[model samples]
Target chain A: MEKVTININGADYSAEVEPRLLLVHFIRENANLTGTHVGCDTTSCGACTILLDGKPVKSCTMFAVQANGKHLTTVEGLAQNGKLSPVQEGFHEKHGLQCGFCTPGMMLTSVAFLKKNPNPTEGEIRWAISGNLCRCTGYVNIVEAVKYAAEKMKESNQ
Target chain B: MIPAQFEYAAPVSIPDALALLRSNPDAKILSGGQSLIPLIKFRLAQPALLVDINNIGGLDYIRAQDGWLKIGALVREADLEDSALVRRSYPLLYDTTLSVADPLVRNRATLAGNLAHADPANDHPATMLAYRAEVVATGVNISRVIPIDDFFRGLFATSLAPDELLTEVRVPMPKPRSGGAYLKMERKVGDFATAGVAVQLNLDAAGKIEQIGIGLTNVGLQALRAKRSEDALRGALPDAKGIERAARLAQEDCDPASDLRGSVEYKRNLVRVLTMRAIEKAIERAKGM
Candidate 1:
């Protein structure tokens, strides 16, 4: 096993891993961050979304060793002081989930989306979340949730 | 999904990367890990080592020098979309990159990796053929410049020797009056192209077509240059009539195969529609820019 050091959610984390271990597996098994889910080995779905060096990437598509020495922000680390992040709050307020299997990835994706485009239009919101699939809400509430997060993020700066 | 075990080396320079790839037989060059990881998980590839080139310094920039655009091998799709050079000088690449999968994939997927992977359904090969780009590759004492047409030889294959790594792509700047566009038909957001078309037109001072380059993808074992379409559009303005004729020629030049993603007839028809749309958009964009 190769020992690699990584920073997750502002905390330094280390683990001994086989070169074959996927980043999602490392986050879940080694770091004990189970909030990120894996839907497919192919990166077609956004179920394993996480921030690697502040950019959202499908954790299932990346190796743990590839992320060594990089900053990782997973779904479990989204809140601050036990309060929900704006994306989480927005998702909760808008009821953007049903089975909740895809929420963590959705929130992480939303966090990255809002940073790139704080005021995404309806079309942009739909396009931004196209990578993330939701069989439950038909994406109506998810779009609203992203809008809510954007609005809340903007208001917080004032 | 755990990939088979391999040695990992992240080299920060081209020479170091080359050395790493040289020392390890069956070591794969990993740029973005988009295509490689799935191959690893499925056990299609059991590389003994993975030499990651993402950290290769000075290889992530797109620069214009001597009338040719030089895109480093590490330049990510997101970097292409966000790059002012590509957006302003090569809008077709920018538009096509933006249309690939989505933002997250673009953020990690590199242009070199896309071309090196050489999947027939990949959208970039068509655009590269349209641009007449030269693919540069390096291996042990081997450096070659391969034209886009010769780069891809078959389905999911390229001319790149196993020891060679694609280093940079050199694209000549189009003439001042030239314009280009790329269009693709995909079944889903993340699926490969059912068929794609990339059209480039260079107009004379009188707004008549001086030269035309057309490329089609997913209609063959490899992306094809629509020689018939180019022959039809030569010395003609890509007006409605010319575009219509070129679209037919585009379809005539392709031999798409039926697969799970699309039928042969549907893919051939997409070659027509996407070819027409791409040519029209290229002409309109040319007039404006």
Candidate 2:
């Protein structure tokens, strides 16, 4: 076993982890943050998406040992001071989810996407979330949710 | 899914990493871990030791120097996608980088790892073949340059030795009146190429094809340089007849096996059509249209 310290959502979670332990497992089990879901476990599905040093990456495919000393932002980091983040509010207001299994990953990807491209066209929005799959809502409402978040974030200068 | 247990080491320098690799033949170098970790999780690759190289600095770079575009091993696919130099000057490379898996995967996938993985269906090999690129492989106290032609040995194999690490990739700068394009067809987003073609060419002042390169992806044992097609187009006028002849030659040279993606015949036909379209698009870009 190896000792690793990963900064998740601004809190340092230090633990003794085996080399085979995946980052998704670390976040869910060790840190007790179940917000990041593991859908496919393979790289194809983006359900375990999180921000590593400000870049969105799938956590299931990466070992926790590889993330030592790295800064990660999981879905638990979306809101500020118990208030729902713009993306969370957008999803709720826009009815962006049905099953909601893909909600956390989708919101994390959208948060990172909007930070980069504040004002995205509909085509760009679709392309941005192409990595994160949503079996419910047919992705129409999810697209609307991202648009809503983008507008809100722009207004708040976030 | 959890991967098989292994020992890990994060080396802070190239010499230290090379020493670890030399001492541990069963070690696997981990860069972005986008590809390697998947293999590990599936138990397809169970290395005894993983040499995590992310701690090493000065390797993640994409710069144009000495008339060649240099790409460090740590340069992620997203870096290429975000580079204005790549977008404005290297259209072929730009298209290939953007064609890789997806934005999320591309964020952590390195170009060097893609070529080193040597998967025929991966997008960058065809573009590297078209560019006639070379890779710098470094061992303990020694380094050698291997042209892209000699890089891929077979299916999921490369010329890199167990103790040597691929450090940099070098592509010749595009000359004036030269342009290129990579055309890929996939069943869906984030899927490997069903069939792909990369075409790079230069036009003389008289509008004749000065020199050309064509590469075929996922239609052979490895990425293939269409030498016969390239020979056919060299010094020829950029016209329908010449382009058709070249495309036919490329089709004849590839050897694809039938699978879920498509029949062998369909892939060969796709290659022909994409080759023609790519050459036309390349010519148009070369003329600044």
Candidate 3:
């Protein structure tokens, strides 16, 4: 076992996890932050998306040990105390989900993506979230949700 | 799913990474973890340790120096997507890499990791073959260069020594007016290649085919340079008749394997179709250059 200290969602966390333990397992089990969902063991599905050093990545595909001492932002840490993030509000307003299984990963992944390429078009937005699959929304509404979030983010920045 | 128990260490420098690999020859080098982590979940690979090279600096760059395109081994596909050198000089590599998995996977996966894994279905091997790239590897106290074709041994196998790591990929610039492109068929956006073709076109002063090199993938145990196709293309017109004949020769050169992608015969047909498409695109690219 390797003892690792990771800063996830602005919190410094220390744990003694097996070397093979995935970042998703570490977040969900060790830190007890289960907002990040694990849908596919393979890297094919991106339901376990999170921000590693401010970039979106599949947490399940990364070893917990690999994330040692890195800044990670998950869906659970998106909002301020007693306030929902704009991305969270976008999903609710757009009816962007039905199963909600892929919601947390989808929202968090989009947060980092928009930050990198802000004011993206519909086509770019679709391509950005291509890794995070949504079976329920069929992606029509999810794409709109991202656009909505972009507008909100732009407003907040102004 | 959790991988089997193993020791993991991420070294901060080349010397530190080398020491870790030297101590654990049975361990695996974790790059993007896109491919390695999946294999671990399936229990297909059970390495005793994982030598993480993510933090090791000075291994992620692509520059043109001394008449060669020098690409550091740790350069990610995302880096390639944004590389001005690749876009300006080697659009074939850019095109081939853009078709890899998806944007998210490309952001994390390294170019060296893909080539080093030596997957038969990978799209980049054939491009490297046509470009005549060389793999530079560093061992304990020695560094050596291996030709692309010789570096890949078989399916999911490579000639890379356990203690050695790929350091650089150098693609020698072609003569003036030479161009290349990779064309492939996939069932879905991120699906493995059904059959792919990478073709290099070189024109003489008179705009005729001075030389040609064709490399094919998903047609055999590993990617094969289509020597027959290249031979047929040399000294021919860079026009309709020449491309048609070369496309036919490209089909004759292939020995495809049957799988979920297609039957051997279907792959042969695809080789003909894609070879024609790639040759045309390559000619256009080369002409512009």
Candidate 4:
């Protein structure tokens, strides 16, 4: 077993895990942050997306030990003090989800993307979320949700 | 899917990593884990030990030195794609890096890891071949630089030994009046290329091709350099007829197998079309168009 300490949602949590334990499993099982879903264990689907050191990555593609001493942000971390983040609020406002299975990953992916590209075009938003798959909403509302979040974030900063 | 149980070591230095590899012959080096982890979950690879090298601090830079653009082994694909230096100095590499998986995967996928994994459908091999890049590998007893052409042996195979770690990739600076491009056709977003072509060409002062390199991906056991097409284009005027002839030669050079992406004939057609378009764009860029 390997001992790993990771900061998730701004709190430090340590656990003894097997070397093969994936970060997604660690987040869900050990840390008890189940907001990050595991839709496809393969890297093709972004349902397991999370922020590692502020950059978005598929947690399924990483081992818990690899994230030792790193800061990770999951969908749970996006809200603070019972208020939703801009991305979460935008999803609520734009009806970004239907079945909502792909929302956490989609929102986190957009959080990182909008941090880099705050004002993305419709095409750029589509391209940014290309790794994520949504079977229910057809992605038209997801794009609008990202745009709404971008505007909200820009307004807050101003 | 769960991976088989394995011992893991995170080494902070090159020597320690090499020593770990020497001690465990069946150990696999995990850089980004974008490819290795998925394969492990699928049970396609079952290594007894994993040597994690992400803690090595100096191996994540992109710089131009000694007439070559040196990208450290740990530099992620997203880093290369977003680098201003890469966009300005090596736009072809930038374009190719952008075509890799997607932004999320690119955030963790390393160029060295991608080449070392050596998936024929991956974009970097053919692009590296077009740039005549070299891979720098280091082991306990030796450090050698292997040219891209000789690095890939076959499907998912490379010249790197078990005890050696690839440290960096060095691409020669583009010559004056030279430009390059990488064009790929994928089945959908984030899918591997059905067919791809990377072309680099230099034009002489008189508007003829001085030097040329063409590489094809996903149509062979390895990234195939289109030597026949390159030979046909060298010293030839950049024109429609010459481009067509070279494209035909490129199509003839590939040995694609039918898969979900397309049939052998369809991939060959893509190779021809992409090669022609890449050559035309490269020629136009070479003349500063």
What does DockQ give for each predicted structure? 0.78, 0.89, 0.70, 0.89
Q: Write the per-residue lDDT of candidate 2 for residues B195-280, one digit (tens) a residue.
A: 99998889989999898888888998899999999998898887899899999988889998999999999989999999999999
Can you write out model 2's per-residue Cα lDDT over A1-158, one digit (the tens) per residue? 99999999999999999989999999999999998998988888799999999888999978899899999999899899999999999999999999999999899999999989999999999999989998878999999999999999889984
Error in Å for residue B236 of model 3:
2.5
Q: What share of the true interface contacts does candidate 3 keep?
A: 0.70
Per-residue lDDT of candidate 1, residues A1-158 (tens digit): 88899899998889888888898988888888899998866887789999998888899888888889999998888989999999999999999899998889888888988998998999998887788877688898998888999999999988
Roughly what TM-score does model 4 have, to 2 decimal places? 0.99
Q: What's the candidate order when arranged by decreasing lDDT?
A: 4, 2, 1, 3
Interface RMSD of each: 1.2, 0.9, 1.2, 0.8
Model 2 Cα displacement at B196 (Å)?
0.8
Clash pairs, model 2 backbone: none
How far residue A123's Cα lies from its native spot in candidate 2, in Å, is: 1.0
Output the TM-score of candidate 2: 0.99
**Per-residue alpha-carbon lDDT of candidate 4 for residues A71-157, written as tens digits (9 for 90 to 100):** 999999999999999999999999999999899999999999999999899999999999999999999999999999999999999
Each prediction's TM-score versus the true structure: 0.97, 0.99, 0.95, 0.99
Q: Which candidate, 2 or 3, has the higher TM-score?
A: 2
Off by over 4 Å in 3: none
| Global Cα RMSD, each model | 1.5, 1.0, 1.9, 0.9
